[model samples]
Target: MVTRDRCRGALLGLAVGDAMGAPTEGMTPEAIHAAHGRVEGFLHTQASGTDDTEYAVLCAQGLLAHGRRLTSNDVAAVWTRAVLSQDGGFHGAGFSEMGAIANLRAGVAPPVSGNDNHESWSDGAAMRVAPIGVLCAGDPVEAARLAREDAQVSHAADGIYGAQAIAAAVARALVTDDHTEVIAAGLAAVPEDTWTARLLRQALDVASHAAGMAEAERELYRRIPLFHYPWPDSAPEAVALAFGLFAAAEGAFVPSVVSAVNIGRDSDTIAAMAGAMAGALHGETAIPRAWRTKVRQVSGVCVTATAGTDLVDLADALYEASQGNEEYENAT
Candidate 1:
């Protein structure tokens, strides 16, 4: 199922693990193992992708200019005409997109400007909800209700339930290849009395009873208390440390995106949401052709309409608009 080389390897493995964890975002996994002892590859040499691959290629070009009747004011007017009426602003964006661009430049519109006077919950809507998991690829609850209507606009309530649990685990990893049934369909699309679903169900039950990946990162840091937040970019700590490193790399794909770029704070949006769930559970020939020939295309340093955006030809036009929205919902 779900091919197109795993939808162009889940958007080129989320822009090659967001340009290999953009310079170790705010290092401190022991200062990224004393400054790069284990990044493994592609730390630089023109590595790019920032605002989490330009807000997931402007939400897959607004789900192909409005499909399945996309709204939330058409994703807040596609973030006010491709990033707040660009002019070399909004680069490397954060702080819930600078508090929804100061409440959409004070005109404040969109789920009330994503909670105006924002109290950020970070992970900036799970790093652009992976194009609503390629526009609801296999419909994990309509990709968690279009990722909570494009994450309220910027994020709120456990950061819009951590972008609806990584858009329902990349829409069940684009249709079953069973990584624990795609993390149990992204924890059954949220609401197990959240704190982002109890730290993603206690970090996928201690990464499903760890045995590897350094004993599942030391039994998920001795059962998650995460050193009282010294930055993991809280969308419930970067979506429970990207679903506990994709259940401690049981999903493989380069050991769950090189353990999300050596597990540093917000390391390129947790290695672009664990490289879009292990490139939608191992596709695009498991991404490694010299890092897909330096995964180029993005130039707008962080959302200037994603300057040249070509994330594997916009994920093959969002997998051909999710096969015309699953044949217009099976012809209504």
Candidate 2:
């Protein structure tokens, strides 16, 4: 039951959220409030998505090219052609991706490329995994499996787990209106003993009791123990924060994405992930017309080849690919 609207919403919502959150990224919640005074909408007149949206487009292309048979090698091959061969440096790409690219340049393969990287626990994988969910709608297990295939190329452990969680959640959201159930599906995709799982549970617990987004932010900031690093791209923390905000907002598209943006700290990726879940739950109609229109075509600030790519067309192609996979699976 993966309708066209839901498919459009997932990709468009992710791009819009990434754009909306870009201005406030890396700032603290207090800093965001001090600067923007509660970001209710887009900060710039002509907003554009950053690396988050570009990487997502890359992922959608990968899925379309390989379908359900997508492997880590397939992902690496795509990256080699699309990412590594690009003329300039990967401008706004995340640390994990840069690490993987460096490894790939040295002829190292994935799982090893990801493992040898220093930022393997970053949220880079989760930021671009929503398409796997769109294709595997109502089948969280398949979504998680495919997400791992994509993630293992540049992430490991909690990073891969975070991608799996978001993919599984988006898949469940495509079929159910209950946000709690959607979150449960995501949790089920990963091991309970993992840091991602533990942080996710704690995030939800804090969000459940909070009065509003501000309170939830405070509680999450206090409760979650972040690594003593300069960057705030921890996969476990970002996924936990995104899902917690999604739960708090009860899966409302605008509110969930906006809250994640305002909460700051890797805001673009956090909002993008939340927006993907909410969009899957509610469909394209839930996204505001203005926001969706702004992100229809990516700016390709990170992945140059994805410039001018229309998310709507990609979404439709993904939906059709999903149908083809279903037909093939049935025939087999």
Q: Estimate each model's TM-score.
A: 0.33, 0.96
Please, what is the whole-model Cα lDDT of each candidate in the order they appear? 0.77, 0.89
TM value for model 1: 0.33
lDDT of 1 at 198: 89
lDDT for each residue of candidate 1 in 155-175, tens digit (9 for 90 to 100)? 768888888878888878978
Provide the lDDT at 139 for model 1. Answer: 83
Model 1 clash pairs are none
lDDT of model 2, residue 9: 89
Tell how far residue 4 is off in model 1, in angstroms.
Answer: 3.4
lDDT, model 1, position 282:
84
How high is the lDDT of residue 238 in model 1? 71
Task: Give the alpha carbon lDDT tens digit for every residue of 1-332 in model 2.
Answer: 67989989899989988999999989987899898898989999999999999988888888887788999888898889888989987777899999998889899998898888899999999999999999888999999999999999999999999999999999999888799989999999989999999999999999999998778877876776474778989999999999999988888999899888988889999999999999999988999999999999999888998999989988888887777744322211
